[model samples]
Target chain A: MTTSPIADALRLPAGPVDLTAIETDAKPGFDGKKADGKGALFAMGDELADLQERLWAQRTVGSERRVLLVLQGMDTSGKGGVLRHTIGLVDPQGVRITSFKAPTDEERAHDFLWRIDKGLPPAGYIGVFDRSHYEDVLIARVHDLAEPAEIHRRYGAINDFEARLADSGVAIIKCMLHVGADEQKSRLAARLDNPDKHWKYNPGDLDERASWPAYREAYEIALERTNTDVAPWYVVPADKKWFRNLAVAQLLLDTLRELDPQWPVADFDVEAEKKRLAEESPVQ
Target chain B: MTTSPIADALRLPAGPVDLTAIETDAKPGFDGKKADGKGALFAMGDELADLQERLWAQRTVGSERRVLLVLQGMDTSGKGGVLRHTIGLVDPQGVRITSFKAPTDEERAHDFLWRIDKGLPPAGYIGVFDRSHYEDVLIARVHDLAEPAEIHRRYGAINDFEARLADSGVAIIKCMLHVGADEQKSRLAARLDNPDKHWKYNPGDLDERASWPAYREAYEIALERTNTDVAPWYVVPADKKWFRNLAVAQLLLDTLRELDPQWPVADFDVEAEKKRLAEESPVQ
Candidate 1:
């Protein structure tokens, strides 16, 4: 069966998705969902594994092209799930994941990019950032972490920072995992109720929930200002975890396929090396 | 079955290991083979995963404690395999991986720790470094990446740096994956002969192989000097990939088990929250 437009847009394989399109008072107004595509999702997962291995093999040649996947989202928006499921499918050797947290005393002493610049993946490697530099715009704006005037400058600084990264041969894929406030509340409450998940509950989460509208506005501004072609942000409907994973994986594959990397051929004598191996073996 | 003492020391699971002990004219060595008590090796891996999950759960409560695992070894040492297998066992939500490469112009402008400090795992998280600050003492000392005088200073700098990290509540685990030169040659030759593996063969690797004695000397000095009580270095026999994975995992598990973190109980009025959920139900 052919995939529908929404399926293709979400990068889900040919299958049904159990989802509902809902409207919110937020500026974007609505989000769409498809039926569950678990089968195709797992199949695409396998394909992602193969693609990752191929990319890893290419990396062995020490090429100078890099890939960076940045994940931005509200709490409980499935960013962690997407990262876990997708990276699970790649060769760990060629993949690196960096999760940015609140700045420490030493980190605050330097410019914001100081920490980010060091975490860039090496050439021919895949780097995933869970909550990246956009925090400067989102949290800083919402929580008033920085002066209001300084926050305005950070918007421009972030745009230039990402533009420079894109120009430097890094294919940047920024994903904004979008989940409704109600969905987030459900997930957060679930964590509180479950004994095994009790560790994942915090009073501060409720406080953040109180400022959801403000954070949403901040997110919109951040996306509009910094979403350039080089590192455009894809606002993903993340209420459906499976679909989100499939979408991000497809995006990664589409990007890597565009690179069309080849396994560099060996210049040395393979036969001689094999012969040497045989000579050293007792079986001979 | 109970594990053997050496197997226990190496942290191998209950399985056959392809043990090979090597002895040069000056020194004797061992190879990969089945050993008794290998199960103990896996104990650490399990402990690490438990610790990681606890840390991840703590993030919701805003408790930050960073855990850094640093793996260093010679070529053909099982660093890749250990990383792949151990990380696979952890909850990806709370973990990040950073692989250090040759510094770019921007990175070179800062202190050696600058790049690494940026990649530190956020509090309540685990970070794995494929190769780490030890590169200053290993590669820099081996290839003269920095001046001779600078190399000596870096060793002390690294010690002080790691101590500072420990003081700041970052538990550090440093492992040296050990493999003999002969085994390295064998693995390198294997990569050269297999067309599927040809991409992994770098001609420059041969040059590094030629400097095996120097690298070994540098590593020995590094292990002797920088390994402290806060961050002791374990010389793991990495000729066997399975044993290496099991041992590293066990070490991580042991360290994490010691922390024994518990999930924070939510203090919110659960009955009120449940009432709210009911009141907010769509049917209502």
Candidate 2:
């Protein structure tokens, strides 16, 4: 309902989308310096932490508002980085994070949303999907993993699913980190070049990267079809890691500020209860 | 396996057991002071944290060692406290916690372990189950929720399941926080007498307490049948909250130390990687 400059600039276009037309190097937020951006992120991170605490406490005495942050991106676009930074700012008890991977045989037997439903945050908690149901269209489409008719049905399924969640008081935030082919290549190469980072660089990623043009087309259509007012998508320019982090953080901070949850009032008589506790013997 | 003095003292006896015979105030590893117990717990907590870090990092490179810490106890027995204190010492990214509550309609339709198997910690993670399969014997038996024959069948099934996990490289540490009726009454009353603690105090807990004798008998039987060389049960004297936390932390720290996972050796050519990385454009 309210606008922030970063949100306005980064939200996907209303009409048809062309991935090639967007600049992947833009920084809509802080002046372009890693130190300044990092500094600003942590500072905003503290505010996010305080708001998160209030959100958690409010739920303890029965407030119903919750948040679901869905992250989608190509390999090396830093979905893990966003989760580590953003969730690191909140209490682990108050946040539920599920990093969806290749579906299991059991998961495949059911509808795509079965596991997603299980991972939804209980009231007043922040739920994050590191990669989400959007993958059905992204990779599944790129690899011909599903029928074209099925993939088409899934886009509508996702919209209806998100609409149902919104009706039940979930505030949805979805982001796609827009990294360039060259940027992803350099990141993967950096992983190869650092022994400590080796585990993170999967050889399979290069296989996925080989199909970048097809994946990009799938993403364009997916975004155009699924970007609803209820759960719109934001395309974050991620060639600069710091700017990407900043934009995502700003989006969360603004969205949470609008929710403005408060701690619940105590329901019992404070004085009488304190006296009763004093009368009970201490631990033996 | 090497033994810690605390483990030797607290590990459940091999045969039939009486809950009443055990002292609820023993601090086997600590001097008789809250400060001393708290200090020693934290000292061991740091050691656990370091070992957990190595185990997590090692798995990223490739190590099969993983830990499953299953905590079983009645209400107000400090399972949540143990989770908060012990797991608070480890990286959240490396620990997978599943706090099992009552089974849902879907969960009840399958075998009891169906959901438990789904939640088993992946390789390289420490999995903590707040309540576990043992509940089938404990609550199900006491409340007449299942047939005696079904409960009898479940014990062998549980042992088989644990053996499978052991064969797959999972180290199991199961503990029962042995709090006396007096201690539970005091804790429940403490909740009732504090306005801030009211949410934790369910009035139905009193109804459960009315069946205390039956529950105790059920727990004694459950512990007897499930305690094995592969996955032994430790009955913690949990009337003293500090001692309970210290004993659980000491168990985890000692178990992890024995596993002794280390950072994996890198598999790539370091010198060549450094040279090739120098040729790529630096992150701008």
Candidate 3:
């Protein structure tokens, strides 16, 4: 469902995904100044909305195709920004957003992917994962939450899980929002400065921030190991949030456009129905 | 989902859907001749399409509400007509239609409701069944497809099945499209006369048509036994196909309006998202 647009440059090449080689403030596609970019973003939003409505309409009559946008980013890497700015353009009813948090007691009891299976968008939906199954490999690897042997096992499991979803009409678009350490610090400082944002500025985010190098190393390994043909990975630069939002929007719009779902053919006899309606209806 | 509009007159009273007592030609809610009724039908269509899109949108954002429209009638009772005219008014993407045929080996392997379970629409969807579980009682009784004892057991099973569906945010609207024998005979003759409609004119339909009285008795027994508060049956007079379409559309529209789902609140920190976007986004 993905097209080889310029946005594909944002994707990590197969094998090892070198974090240092990828720019955290890249703006390859957007040529305009911020004002023009924002205008373009709004225009993209309208197109995304129309495309999403068409997707919903196609699915309503029984198309089984779907799209999933998997977003993985560190604290203040603009995952939420992309959500609010890009995915938010589409109607919420056609969008399924799952913000994976600390596992609940019931979720903890099941396998890591169990909750993911439950959260998948049904056929003909656009699903956004704020933080997803990638957490199992990323956080778990950085913190040594699982055994080394088990972590490697999960990589294969993740690939298989994504493949199964893809086989069942899910077009997976995985994104890693790349941010420089300096950019992260500035965003964190801004959060602390704003009193209203105190609610969002979780103290634990600082704890995770402390493990930054480990987390980035973990992400490189994840992107390399789980970067798939069925579920391709895109590395969006997060230092410039506008660029990040635009790239993500363009990426999604490109995929949806490629899907190009149509209105379903009428399942009933159209001519007979028209004739019946004409005969029965007393319209002049 | 059955509203107490003037259309309520079309519904068989709670006791029994007495096929004999009910007049098939009655157009209770439709006041005008064919012309006015057609105008009203188009108005209802516009309203239905809008409401259905809203429903699809609401469900996309994680609502578990849905509607299951179970349609049944003797052959040529305008089930296909309703699909083309009324349900067609709604976008195909939001509607899931199931035309249940004779149970497959896999379906028959499980209990009767297994196929139904596989076909129930997900939340935020409108599911239409051209012929549904009612056939378990109606056809199985008249044609001796299942045992008399098993036929009685199925009624209880069906009640339990619909109750489970209703409890899980599905609004069930079952309609028995009632057509008088003479009306059916004329419609069948017209189908024979029209070469274009030959695709719809099944030779097996004539075989079923021959056992009309037996099917009527079986339907009478089935309707009386299974009508519950959770999934009530609305016996729509189908001799006037226009009235049938309008009544069904009105019923579905009224149900969706009653559900009246609102757009979901943002799950993210809105003000914080706005702030971050303002700071990081170079846009004025």
Candidate 4:
């Protein structure tokens, strides 16, 4: 798929961003590839692997740098694809992933952050939240998880929560996988049409579709309120799955590269240890 | 680095076997090749990328296949190396890792299973526990997490808990990294000798060393009690880092391949979607 040159040039806001501008500027069909035919997925994969290694090493050496990746998106927005591709590049030990479903009674008993806090990555670990704390502001606001006034309050609370986590040495990267309405409808239809994927289809998704404008408005407001310098949101173009993954992976790699942890030297004498092993052998 | 031919030819048991016999009989060294020969470190970098992709795919489809990787070991058993290598092969999106640290007040409040249950992988996810529920039996019996009688109960509970999770479709792979006492002493000494790693050196670890025979007894009991057909434990040789990683990775990949989830197909009309995209593009 091809995106317009103008749309292609649009850079996602790095820190606090104007939600209206972000929404408007984020064209749905923006092609991740230019005429060069180079897709971002492969590049991102390579970089992600490198970053994961560096991060894993840091953890091994007792450096407590934690990273929280928040992925928020509309249906068919390539969240899954991006997640799949990005994780493909990292060490499994240093990473954790959590996907939030409807709030169970136990979850609803606690404040919104309760379940989330439990899922946070340990020091020097990476935690990926498929849908995260932002759900309070997004779905809750749309479905009335709270009063409108309370929803407004959640925005600030979430911002503070993420900022505090960032201040405590956690790197937060929030990606809003942006897709077009047409794309969402088609993808939703695909779910309905396929026998194997029927499990993923929900009648309520279409009900939400009728209120797309409201959800979009809620998303814009949430983005406006929560986007911070310490914990920023990236409005990634998600029409292309490969590009989305590549972009997120690159972003992750770039962030870790900035951390720049050094590999610690192994303290053992290799030759001496080998000799000791040989001497200890019964046959030897 | 290579094992004797006689040792290589020996057949090992697939079920519960003596660690000493396996160590003596099996070929030494990891069969898994590093992605690149910057030693294990560089190979780890490459493997992370591959893992990320697989994880992302799992997450995208919302598949319920969860991976529970258990890393168990004695002190200085190269658990760190195994972790480094394993993490090097996964994507952060669908992967979650929890290292069982010393218990806290909150942990003590719950049954041994509670803390572990909180860390269990969601459907279509991968979860790694550095030291796991088995600790209830291993350390509990070794250091006495409970009374000797209570330890017996916990053993059954641990086994049942794992059996239930496996029945619920969790693919559990447990590795008991084996290292010689002399090798361990050398590693512990290395930690003390290196100023940078001094923080990791606890004098208490030496106290544990004094009770090595007791701990081994505890390990034997724990293995006998908990090694069910569903969650079989592999007593991995840890002296050779490369061989250990290869064995573990192969086991994991083989398990995942066995599950064999089909990739989500593109359900839209590819030609139409492409043509629509092209027609909509001004430049195209």
Q: What is the RMSD, in Å, between candidate 3 and the native fold over all Cα?
A: 9.7
Tell me the deviation in Å of residue B189 in model 2.
Answer: 4.3
Candidate 2 on A7-78: residue-level lDDT in tens?
888888787889888778788645558888888887886688768767877777777789998989998998
Error of 3 at B237 (Å): 0.8
Interface RMSD of 3: 12.1
Q: After TM-score superposition, what is the CA distance of residue B167 in candidate 1 from its true location, in Å?
A: 4.0
Q: Residue-wise lDDT of candidate 3 within B1-284, one digit each (tens)?
A: 44646447665667755578788898876677777766777888766766766676666467889999999998889887787678756655566777788899998889889999988887878988889989999888889989899999999999998998889999888899999887876776675565434444555665576578789988888888778877877889889888888889888887888787664444456576545534543210
Clash counts for all predictions: 42, 0, 11, 25
Candidate 3's residue-wise lDDT over A1-284, tens digit each? 45545466776688976788888887765677677767877788777876776687677567788889999998899887787567656665566677798789899799889999998987778988889999999899999878899889999999999999988888788989988877886787676665434444655665576688788889989998998888889998889887888888888888889888664544556566545533442211
Per-residue lDDT over A76-195 for candidate 1, one digit per residue giving the tens place of the 0 to 100 score: 887778876776666666677787989888888888878899878877788889888899888989999889888899879988998898888788888878787777878877876787
For residue B231, give model 4's deviation from the true position in Å.
Answer: 3.7
The lDDT of each candidate is: 0.70, 0.81, 0.78, 0.65
Q: Rank the candidates by lDDT, best first.
A: 2, 3, 1, 4
Residue B151's lDDT in candidate 4: 89
Q: Could you give the CAPRI-style class of model 4?
A: incorrect
Deviation in angstroms for B113 in model 3? 0.5
Q: Residues B1-284, candidate 1, lDDT per residue (tens digit)?
A: 13233334543222222222222111112234445224544445455666677777766677766778898887678677776667766766566777888877888999999999997987887788989988888888888889988888888898899999999878887877877667777888888766767876666766576677678778777877786878777667766666667666766765676556777666676666655654553420
- Supply candidate 1's per-residue lDDT for B281: 33
- Over B1-284, each residue of candidate 4 has an lDDT whose tens digit, in order, gives 13222123321335454555556213344333444223544444454444434444555556567788888887777666666566555555556667788788999888888999988977766677888877777777777669988888887898889899988879887777777666677776676665555545555666576667777777767777677778876667666566666666655665566566554554445445434433442210
